[model samples]
Target: MSSYVEGALVEGERIVHAGRISAWALWHLIGLGIILLPAFGIGLVFLIIAYVRYQSTELAVTTKRVIVKHGFIRRQTVEINLSKVESIQVDQGVLGRMLNFGTLIVAGTGTSHAPLAGIADPMAFRKAFIEAQDEGQEGI
Candidate 1:
C-alpha cells in the first residue's frame, strides 16, 4: 500500500462505499503478462509501470462525498460532496458487463471539474454513496 492511508475512518452499520480501481485493473496486468512481458522487455517495463500507476490509484467513498486519489509524485485527489452531485452514471464495457465492473461518473449541479472514472461495481457504488449520504442526513 501507499502507506498514505495507513489508517482511515468508515461509518455506519451498512456503510456502502465505492469500490476501488485496484480491484478491477487486473485485466491490464494479465494482458501484459500473457502478451507482452517476455516477448518484449520494453513493453513489459511499460506494463509494469502501468500496473504501478493503477495500483497507486484508489477510489475512496464516504457518506459525505466520493474521493479519487491517484498519481505518484503529484498524488491528485478529488472529492465531491453529495450535495453537489446532480447525477451519477455507470459505464460498463464488454468484460465489465460480464464482471460487473464499470466506471462511475458523477455530474455536479454546477461547474463540475471532472467526472469520476475507472470504478468497479459502479451501480453499487452509486447506491452506497447515496444511501450513506441519506443516512448521514437522517442521523442529523
Candidate 2:
C-alpha cells in the first residue's frame, strides 16, 4: 500500500480491493534486455522504468470510491464516487485474455472515462468495484 493512497482515504472508507500493475507491462524491458544483451547497462534503464511504473501506479476500490494513482515525481490521481460510476469497461486482447491481464475503463456519469492499461486481473477488479457499488447503493 502506498502512502499517497492511504492518505487519500476518507473517514470510514475501507479498501475493498487493490489492483496491481500487470507483469505484461514489463514486455518492453524484456525485449530491450534481449536486444541489448551485450550492452547490459542500456537494458538496465528499461528495467528501471518498468519497475518504477509498476511500483508508482496504484489502483484501489474502496467503500466510498475508486482511486487510481500514476507517476512518481509528477503524480496523477483519479477518484470517482461509487454513486457516480456508470460502468467499467474491460479490454482484453488475445494475449491479454490468455495472460489474464487487461485494460479497465471506468466511466463516470459524464463523458469522462479513466482508462487504466496493463492491469492484472482486471475482471476481478471490476467485480469488486461493482459489488462495492451495489452494497453502497443498498445502504443509501
Candidate 3:
C-alpha cells in the first residue's frame, strides 16, 4: 500500500506523530462537552474549525526528512532537514506517557521554522532522528 507523503525532509526517522481522522471528536468533546455553550450557533463556528483540525493533523518522519501537513480545504506543509536540527526533545504529559503519544520538539540549528512540531512518540523518534542527523552530517 502507498500513502501520499507530503514533500518533507527526514532521514531514517520513524513517524513521531500521525494523528487520526477521529481527532475531530476531540474538539466537540472540548468545545461542547467542557465549554457547554448555551447557544450552539456561534460556538458552532469554532466547532467547525476544531473538526477541520481533527482532520488536518498529519505529522510524520521518514528515512529522509520531517513532514508536517495540516488544513482541510487549503493545505499547509512544512519540512525540516535533519542536518539543520540542533537538538531533539520529547515531551510527555501524564496521559501522553501512558498512551505512547507525546510531542516531539525539534530544535533547529538556525531558524525555528526548521523544526517539526507536535509529533507523537517523541522519545523513540528523537533517538533515531538524532542518529540519522549525525549520520547525514558525517557523510558530508
Highest-lDDT candidate: 2
Report the C-alpha lDDT of model 1 over 1-140, residue by residue, as the tens digit.
Answer: 43333234345332246466634546666566657657757557757766777777766667666677778787887767767877777778888887777777778778785555666677777788778778777977
| Rank order (by lDDT, best first) | 2, 1, 3
Best TM-score among the predictions, by candidate number: 2
- Model 2 global lDDT (CA atoms, 0 to 1): 0.90
Candidate 1: segments with Cα more than 4 A from true spot? 1-18, 22-33
Estimate the TM-score for candidate 1: 0.75
| Model 2 ranges off by over 4 Å | none
Model 3 spans > 4 angstroms off = 1-51, 113-118
> Any residue pairs clashing in model 2, and if so which?
none
Ranking by TM-score: 2, 1, 3
> Looking at candidate 3, what is the lDDT of residue 28?
46
Model 1: lDDT to the true structure:
0.67
Estimate every model's Cα lDDT from 0 to 1.
0.67, 0.90, 0.58
lDDT of 3 by residue, 4-121 (tens): 3533433544554343333422544456644644565666666667666765767655545666676777887766776666776766778667655566667766758433344455
Model 2 lDDT per residue over 1-140, tens place: 54677899988999999999897857878678657766947877777777888889999999999999999899999999999999899999999999989999999998989999999999999999999999999998
Name the better of 1 and 2 by TM-score.
Answer: 2
